[model samples]
Structure formats: C-alpha cells, structure tokens
Target: MEEFFKKYKIELEKEELEKFEKFLEIFKQKNSQINLSAIRDDNGIIEKHFVDSVMLNIFLDFLEIENPKVADLGTGGGFPLIPLAIVNPEVNFVGIDSVGKKLKAIDEFVEELELKNVKTLNGRAEEIGQNL
Candidate 1:
C-alpha cells in the first residue's frame, strides 16, 4: 500500500498508515465472522473501500468550510466514512445505513478506532431527511 499510495501521489502520514493497517486487521476479522462486503479480498478492500474513500480527500481538501461535514448514504460496512474519518479527523462524518446490525458493527469500529468525528445513523435516507 505504501508503494500504491506513492504511485498515486496520495500523501498518507505514518500514523495514518498505521491506523489504516489496524483497521484492515479489524475489518478482516469482523468480515470473516459476518459478511462485511461483497469485495472481500484484501486488495479489493484496499482499493475499492479504503483508497476509494480516501480519494474524496481531494474534494475535501478544497472545502472552504471550517468544519466540513459529509454523509455517506446507504453506507454498508462503514466504507468511505470510516476511512475518511480516520484520515480527516477534523471533518465530521455521518454514515447512514438502514441495517441496525451493520450500524452496530460501525459503532464497534468507531469505539475501537477511538474516533471522535464519526457518527452512524440507522435509518433510510427518506426517514432521516424527513426528521431533519
């Protein structure tokens, strides 16, 4: 992944990389117990889930807002938001999923990752939007 990130000119700090590595381990372990994602392989997870999520950094970097907020609709297994939150600690992320079990897993991941900027909502977009 170091070479992969370097190839793409993605700048990830050592600590961030370490956190991602830890996240990978945790993700794989949990995935085996319960189907986390259709893309199960490590390379697939890294590319599709982790890197794909981090790619949003390019847009987030352009945000002029002081406290940027993002919502990942139908977030299955916490994908972009989890990786995004890990990298962008200053930005707040909301992951909305209809599945309570998936959200529970996300909560566990957030606690294990010691993340302060990530929150999960277990509801469909329509229901959540109506409330807001």
Candidate 2:
C-alpha cells in the first residue's frame, strides 16, 4: 500500500501509512459483518477506496481556504471523508449518510483511527444541508 501510494507522488508519513493500513483492516472486518463496501479484497480497498479518495488532493490547491471545512454527502464507510480527514488533520470533515448502520460503522472507524477532526451524521443530505 505504501509503495502504491508513492507511485502517485502521495508520500504518506509512517504514522499516516500505519493508520491507512489499520483502516483497511477495520474496513474489511466491518464489511464482513455488514455491507459497507463492494470492494472486498486488500487490493480493491487500496485501489478503489483509499487511492480513489486520496485523489481528491488534486483539488486542495483550488480550495484556497485556510483550515477548510468539507462535507461529504452519502459518505458510506467514510471513503473520501475518512481518508481526507486522516491526511488533513487540521481540516474539519463532516460525513453524512442516509443509512444509520453505515454511519455507525463510520463512527467506529473514526474512533479507531483517533480522528479528532471528523463528525458523522445519519440523515439525508437535503435535511442536513438545509440546517447547516
């Protein structure tokens, strides 16, 4: 996974890489208990989930916001949101999903990763967006 990330010039620190590795393990375990993701294997998770999510880094420069806050709608199992939050600990992230169970899994993932900058909401994006 570390080698794969380096191929994209996205060099993760040792700790960050460890967190991503841990996330993969947790994701697989949770997926076994509940349908969190369709990509089941390690390679799939790395390529389809983690790498895909990290690709959002390309837009970071365009954001042009100091200490940016982001909202990811229908962030099932915390795809872009979790990975983004992991890499950018200074930024804030909110992940909203319609399924309560999926949010629960995300909450567990957040806690397991010891992420302080993320929050999860179990509701439709429209309802939550309006209030925010």
Number of the top-ranking candidate, with lDDT as the measure: 2
Model 2 per-residue lDDT tens digits across residues 11-81: 89888899999999999999999998888999989988898899897897577899888999999878899
Q: Tell me each candidate's TM-score.
A: 0.94, 0.97
List where candidate 2 sits over 4 angstroms from the true fold.
none
- What candidate 1 gets wrong by more than 4 Å, as runs, is none
lDDT of each: 0.87, 0.91
Question: Model 2 lDDT vs. the true structure?
Answer: 0.91
Worst 10 residues of 1 by lDDT: 1-10
Query: So what's the TM-score on candidate 1?
Result: 0.94
